[model samples]
Target chain A: MTIKENIFENLRLELRRGCLTLAVLAQLRQEHYGYTLRKALAERGLEIDESTLYPLLRRLEAQGLLSSEWREEDKRNKRFYRLSGDGEGIFVQLLKEWRAINASIDNIL
Target chain B: MDLLDRYLQAVKKHLPWQRQDDIIAELKANLEAQLEDKEAALGHPLTAAEAEDWLKQLGHPIQVAARYQPQRSMIGPALFPFYLYVLKVAFLWATVIWTIVAVVQIAAQTPSELTVLAAVLRVPGMLMTTAAWVTLIFAIIEFVAARCPGKFPMLAPPAAHWTPGDLPPLGQQLSGGRKPRSFAHALTEVIFGFLFLVWWLLVPRHPYLLIGPGVLYWHASPFQLAPFSVLFYWWVVGVNVVQLAWRSADLIRGSWPRPRTAQTIVVSAIGLIPLGLLLSVPDHAYVLLRNPALDQARYSAALTSINLSIQWSAVILCAISVLELLWGIGRLSLDRYRKHAAAMR
Candidate 1:
């Protein structure tokens, strides 16, 4: 892409950044592994690549916003991630804030 | 194992050491799980194209990871104090180094015949050295500050902005203050005035020299010194008188106002005239072209004296510039503080 196009793309990406967390939380309502979460998000029209989704899950886990455990099935181990207690609280707060902001924007529009 | 591994490796390339292993493990687990889900959904083992397509949809690894962590601000809450501290240390170190190099260079050079070239060369070393020292000191402070974060509360997070309406009136701050003009202000003017007068008088005479042959000597022309010589002397007297007046005035008034900017500018201008003459006139050109009548030592001495005078003048100019710049900074800081205080009120 041209420099200007790249810059605009970056700005668009930044604007969409906040929604990514919501999308991650919404998809991980059930225990989902990193790859499964990415596919689910893509299917839901929030199309996150694996590279983006994996680290995010890790960070969310680190911040006590996600819980995860290694499970072995069919002789292969998979790390499954689910919402932590704190994650649930944060997700609810985020969802409320998002709704309020959306409504405010709707009013302004 | 193929394109997926390569893609994963490429993503890992961008991450720092501490998080790299964890990130890699997380990604591997996630990607493996994704591949399994895809296989289950399709009810068959996935083809390479299918896997590539899935990975492609995931976007670049770094971009994906970056979304999870917001970029740290360049002048962020965590780093600004450190940055300013580094800046100040660098400035201080640079100042010290420059002063040392300047003093040494001036001491070593052949003296008496003041040339513009000698003056110009002396400046950069002093400037660079001073800048380096200042930066070094600030950097050290910042380093210490990083360890003991609370020590510098003034430089902490949530940077404040100064606005015009927020400033306290300048007159109010200066009025009814007890301390007279600072010794620094008085000392600076006196020292500068003294140096200027001394350079002017001694430089022309080639004073403190072993008179030698093939040396060029310069005397200040009557026209250059005409009015200013008298005014320069009077200004020195005036500065002392003003210093005394301000001191006595402080006995009645609580505070004294800062030295007026106009006075500084005028004094600086007066100082520059001799400097301009020194630079514009080629004092040593004639020495190289014409043999002088004096003895070898006497002529060499004359040349040395002129060279030393020029070096000293250059140093003085540099010192003056530094002082003015510092004064400007002080003025700015005071203005900002007043504005901040007013805003709080």
Candidate 2:
């Protein structure tokens, strides 16, 4: 890629990075395993790569923002994740902040 | 399929070992789900090649594994610039000490103007050893920093403690207080070098310059400068010329040059020729006075003491010279290397 294109790609990734965490937490309010969650986000036009999604799940769980469990489904094991008590509170606050930012950006644009 | 297992195993290699199995299990379940979904869409089982292509979308093993790991760095980006700066500075000192060691060895063993090049030849080896050692040390620090984030606080920039108000005025630094040695230090070196060059060239004809304060007290009979061999004159001149050139360059460049590891090695080796010459001169060689103070016995004892003082003074000077040169090398190295390191950052 040209340098300008590379720079834009990097800047675009940085722009998306903070939003991805919020999107992941919002999706996990309803229970879903990794593949299903990725599909749900993709369906909403906000696809996250497996590499990014799985790690985000692990980090969120580690931080007590999400809870996860392993269980058998269709004779195969799946690890399902959903928002924890703390995650639910934080998600609500973050959602409010996100909307404020969106409104600010919309006004500026 | 074997391909699926292999991809998981590749990822497993990079995962934190304590939690590796759990992460692998979770990862395996996710990948299996992906494969199942793909198969359902195609209405068929995937071939090995298709399965491999499916795994490729996950990312490389290193990249995938790194996500699970904390952002691993030997030295984090914050400390890496500093760590590399320290190493580059260390390389300068290493090259310098090696240079001195080479010169001293040659001056002591061969004492010829010709052997200066041999001493010069040994500099790269010194720099290489130093560079290796400095790198190894930073690597160890990096290992510690990556494994335990809180340890090695020096690895962090001052921003950890800094308020925006702590910043200097607009004229102040982005990274403050890492500048080259002042022009005064270089100027002093140049002045001293010029003085010494004059002293060596003319101390033969005018003996008063040799006797610091006693010139008025003693009879003004001139003693010969015959004891100083011709090779000795050339060696001293060469040493002074180097100092003059180096200090002059520092003055001009406003810092030491990018360590031409090879050139620096040679220059440092040549430096020893003079230092060795100063040390090896016998205590009785500097008898700059011919006529005695009317008291012969007292005068002979006093002359002996004078020669002895010169020898002792030279010894002290040599020790001090070695230390100061090492320090000079350090400062010069730091100035040059910091610029280089900052550029990399």
**TM-score, each model?**
0.51, 0.60
Q: Can you write out model 1's per-residue Cα lDDT over A26-80, one digit (the tens) per residue? A: 7777988877677677777887755566767777888898998988755667788
Looking at model 2, residue A84 earns an lDDT score of 99
Among these predictions, the greatest DockQ belongs to 2
Docking class of 2: medium
Residue B193 in candidate 1, Cα distance off native in Å: 14
Model 2: lDDT of residue B2:
86
| Per-candidate interface DockQ score | 0.58, 0.73
Residue A41 error, candidate 2, Å: 0.6
lDDT of 2 by residue, B52-80 (tens): 78888778997998999766555567666
Reference-based TM-score, model 1 = 0.51
The CA lDDT at B216 in model 2 is: 60
